[model samples]
Target: MKTIKILLSFALTATLFTSCYTEVVVDDFAYVDEPTISLNQLLRSHELWYVDINSTLGYGETPFLQKAFTVSFINGVVYANNNIAGLGANGDGFGIDVGEYNAYENILDVYHDIDGFSTFDVYEIDYNTIELYNPNNDTSYFLDGYQRNNFDYDFVFYDNIHYFLQEYEAWEKTYTSEYGAINEFDNENYLQFLAGGNDSTFRSSQDDTGINANNLYWDYTGVYGVGDVYGDAYLKTLTLDYDYLGNEYFELSVINDGKIELFHPSSETVYEFEGRGYIQYLKSESGTKKEKVQSDKLRKQRKDKVANPRENTRKV
Candidate 1:
């Protein structure tokens, strides 16, 4: 009887072990049906849409649109400011403002205008999902200089400038300078002074030591975004370091008005500011629109002069 009981116990343990070791098989061929309404269809059904930029930045007061032109699905064309029909020929081009990095729950709102009827909705789309649409519709024109190579099928379109403007304003706030030094000098003069200075006191403090007692060093870091509208200008973390007492300090300084908070990593003290005077000064000193136009015309003339010989040779 004891031997029979031992055999039964071993059988039970073996059964438990086999049950524990059972494998779970997932069917890799399982398929899901595509949604009945394509992103384009949804846009055609809605009239007006706006993306919430505030949703991207953890805390902001506005939203931006993915495209800032009136989209005509029937004609398959996009217009900038509703002026000059052709793409790149006479139009301002499509404006897209992607929001900040921290807002994980943010979405792009697309609006559609149908037969004098307008409706809007927000869709959650990301970088990877936007790669499916064909922007190369024969009748469509992308105003922005950068050509779109990848298309995503799931993107919704919106034709609202007001919505885009609101978001642009918010984004502009991020690039403005927030700090400035009271005493600043021109780059050339400052460099010459530093290089030719005979002051033993200044030299003693800053010469070989990493720690300079007479120099006030300021270091700042900021975050930015990236997209086509602001070609090559994507969101980035920027750092600016300057030695206030050095003449070369002004040349190395950077200014922006965007909401910024400065912290002393050693002491953990934070300083926040809304604007910088240095940037304002530089903007004022830059040439006016008329001067810029003249400069551009001259540059084109020079290029044409250089290319004329090549064209003549080709004709021959």
Candidate 2:
């Protein structure tokens, strides 16, 4: 009787642990749409440009920049361009990649040359439109409706000299993830860039979500390009370094005015952030300039260290 009771208890404990673990997966997106057979011919003539992305599984919000990804079908080869200017050109940034793609009835196969992997089951909506979505799966991902781009727009890349965070910019996590991201702690986080420094505050924090009102800083110079989200979208990438949070590469979209966006970009992992607030932008001169007071203070510190060997230390 004792042995049976112990066995049952062990089995129940094992089941509880098994149910709690969430498996991590890659944010690999494939397109799925349904249209007529003539859609194949339509794809060969024009390019499919990434326009917008909506999170049905996460926040259900649309990204700010809509004209980033470009895909053109030529002969049997699929040409890819990202953050390329002038309606997806032929040289440099445009058509930098050559891959293969095929269609069999409603299903399309895309072979990415960079990844060296061919993805299956992504559908296209006829020939002129492509919606990368999976509505039937329990956990789904999508990129919506790549349109034909003809207008002349210059591509932009992220650079620190031109695109670093402004001192007064206050941005909350506007992007709540899909795939059921766990807060696991109390759920509020906010950050502000201030006067050559970064400050963060967390309200009602959680234990394991890595939420703390600790030190915050930039990891490296940011990057902005006609980068790929589903196919190839454009956004500014900022990798954040924090005392408690470790590192996070935030996908940012700069809309008009102070409006912007943040994306976590992992299919299996989730970050909880939502709601309204404006992002403050710094002028070109103000962002890059340093204050006289700060410079003088730093000089004094170095002077103090050199002035007093016993108070500080002299190595070598």
Best by lDDT: 2
How well is each residue in 1-316 modelled by candidate 2, as lDDT tens digits? 9999999999999887766643211212212233334535655545444332232232221111111244555565655433221223433324433456776553445564433434323435444445433222221223333433542333422322122233223334444555545532114344443322221221222222233324333222322222234543455554544436555555666553234555555433434332222221111133232122211110001011111111111122
Candidate 2: segments with Cα more than 4 A from true spot: 1-36, 54-68, 84-94, 120-128, 134-149, 155-316
RMSD of 1: 22.2
Across residues 242-300, which tens digit of lDDT does each residue of candidate 1 receive?
A: 33442221111112223333332333333432321111100112222111111111000
Q: Residue 226 lDDT in model 2?
A: 24
* Candidate 1 segments whose C-alpha is farther than 4 A from its true place: 1-238, 241-258, 275-316
Question: What's the residue-level lDDT of 65 in candidate 1?
Answer: 21
Give all TM-scores, in the order shown: 0.19, 0.31
lDDT (Cα) of model 1 = 0.23
Determine the backbone clash count of candidate 2.
13
Clashes of each: 29, 13
